[model samples]
Target: MESMNIPMRDILQRILKRRKIRPRPGLNYNLEKQEEPGVSIDLDATLASMDTMEFSLVRENSTRRHHNEGSEDEVSTMADSLTSHQYKSYIVSMVHRLRANTDVQLGVSGEKVEVDPVGSKGTKFFKQRAMTYDADNIASCEVLEEKSTGKSVFRITYLISHDYKHSDFEADSEVCNEIVSKINNILELRLSPARKDYVATRAAKHLRKRDSLRDSFRLSKYTDN
Candidate 1:
């Protein structure tokens, strides 16, 4: 009997990422900066937001206790494990979601081991494992040494440059904006914070009732006051 051959889906394939482009999204991003002369941009990049990281705060007690020879792990292992095993998983998951089917590019670079897709130098050091999600991305990353074994902190930076045309500039800006907006949306769902209603219709509705000549009414007391 001939067996049927149904292809099994690949796990890594499911998590693959792609780069998206607008071709002429909006503004050109590579023009030289107006504020600094001869200091030009390579591409239109935006600093998404800075996320401060506490790589690892070592505990003296742990360090002293582990000082014996042939210790199971060092005080810094806590951070290293956290960053490499746990945090790296989160970052990978995020990149997958954002890049899957969305046309997003990613790359990794350091010591010429890997290359960045964007090909820019603005960076952040994280107690992270080196990763190259895409081939042509810019932004070299490094996993620097931290001081704790329980918590590995990482720094992730978004890079930008000025050599981009207005169209690419706007597209990159829009992408950054979209990411920020998504975060804001998630925050709103949780705290439900109050915001000033700039386009409120309640006041306008009240004014409409006041100005309306369509609902004129007469009141009668008939001296029964």
Candidate 2:
């Protein structure tokens, strides 16, 4: 009976050995090969290359931005130059118009003075007055010739009142307003809207100078006391 039991145990052991599951020899080896250290390093290099490409793209975008800025500056400079040229042309045209106006007379003459007869022996007096015609309470406009070249230039000379003094309030007088209106009309006919503003500014400066001269003369007359 013991001998039969031992043989049966041996047969069971053989069946268990035949049916047991065993690990495949190459599975771990394949996994280790897939996860090798060098393979991970290669993936890192690929990521670095992608970063470099992105940096180059950003640099190119910055370059285009700088180029656009430079073009905009050039366009602004060209526009300024064109504006300056138009202003110069407008000035020349204004000068030509003033020169061609026939109403502006050209010359310079001395003031006339009347010498009174001697009173009571060796008592004589002289009265001097401007020979120019008076314009409506403002100033007389005259063109005087240059001494050297005979070229005529416009001059604004203030007129003395019948009360024997210069008028201090002529800056805003009707005559000045009429003169400014005439200048504005001439500029409007010859200049564009953009250039008219510049010419008007210059005309205002001239008028300011004339007004300043009038004020100075009035001050001098009073200070003599």
Candidate 3:
């Protein structure tokens, strides 16, 4: 039995050496060659390359952050320069004060004022049409009283010699005063140095964009890769 077992073991060893068994498919197997001997590593060079890559990533992130901050500032500045338009409507005249014109409606927004003629449909063609004016164009706004009826009138005077006098408000005295105050506030805000600077900056930006529209695409050609 021992002699037979020894011969069987020798035969098995020879067969294994001659033909190595292939690994089964769908199995985790490492078939790569072993690492070669005498493969030296330069510690300093490896560290230097890693540091260079890290520095490059930091610089790129910093540049991107700066560009994003600049874009946000530009957007905020542009938004500040724009005017608000939350309009407040007021009944200028509760009753008709003029024979030719009927009641009038006043609308006041951030920096704009609109006056509309409210009359019967039959008289609409002959009545004065609605008009809108900027607060910058208006020189003064005041409440005047008619001598005959003692009713409060909202009057807007332009920078020129023009004056817009609408119908009187027999009951809405406080509303007329509030409208005048709002218009005055808007005018004051427009005259501020910051507001003027923003307006000038926006206008310059528009002009620059317009001038560069044709040549903006050519910038990439001159830029370094």
Candidate 4:
């Protein structure tokens, strides 16, 4: 018996027919070139263009990262400055709040002074309002007593935008004097050299007083013996 050679397509068609899958009867199963030839491509040029695009993308990403980093640093620096300013304001307000005088309702702090006056209707209807003055800008503080009324007036001389300005508050003699003294202390401590000298002088005076007391105590013990 002679063996017969069968096409792969015909075998597949027969298998499909057995499985009840019918192919189009008029369809050609032969493998042949039917369309026009494809155009040739330049592999090297294509690769070079892709490399250039990739390098540009990398450079753009790096530049964006650098810009973001710089913006973050600027924002952080601004936040730090804002925090410092807030802390200074808090310290100023706290100092004024604690030691306010009862009669005048005036308070002095390390950085500023505040005065609260009662309205005609009193504090129940009208909330207490405060006026503030900067200690650093103050050039002078004075208290003057009126002969006719026997009331004391407190005057503050300060600078605003390099121009001299003054604010006046009315209080009794004791309150005015206390406010003036506190303001003067702030002004005197403003200069670093003056503050250092004052501290050194105070320390020397305290040491001398302590030594004198010790000597007196020793002499008293000897006399008792």
**What's the lDDT for candidate 3?**
0.46
Clashing pairs in 4: none
Report lDDT (CA) for all predictions: 0.24, 0.29, 0.46, 0.45
45-107 per-residue lDDT for model 2 (tens digits) = 222232211111111112222335655564443223212212110010012222222122111
Instruction: Please provide, for model 4 over 59-111, each residue's C-alpha lDDT reduced to its tens digit, 9 standing for 90 to 100.
Output: 11122233356555644432232122111211111122334423334556665
Ranking by TM-score: 3, 4, 2, 1
Model 4 C-alpha RMSD vs. true structure (Å) is 35.3
Candidates 1 and 3: which is better by lDDT?
Answer: 3
User: Per-residue lDDT for 42-145 in model 3, tens only?
Assistant: 22232223221111111111222333565556434322222223467876653354453346677877666777877643354455567776666665566766
For model 2, give the RMSD to the true fold: 42.3
Model 4 regions more than 4 Å off: 1-104, 117-129, 146-149, 192-225
In candidate 1, what are the lDDT values of residues 78-164, reduced to their tens digit? 222212211111111112222221121322221111212332323363222333322112122222223344322222222224211
What's model 4's TM-score? 0.33
* Worst ten in a row by lDDT for model 2: 85-94
Give the 10-residue window scoring lowest on summed lDDT in candidate 1. Answer: 1-10
Rank by lDDT (best first): 3, 4, 2, 1
Clashing pairs in 3: none
Better-scoring candidate (TM-score), 2 or 3: 3
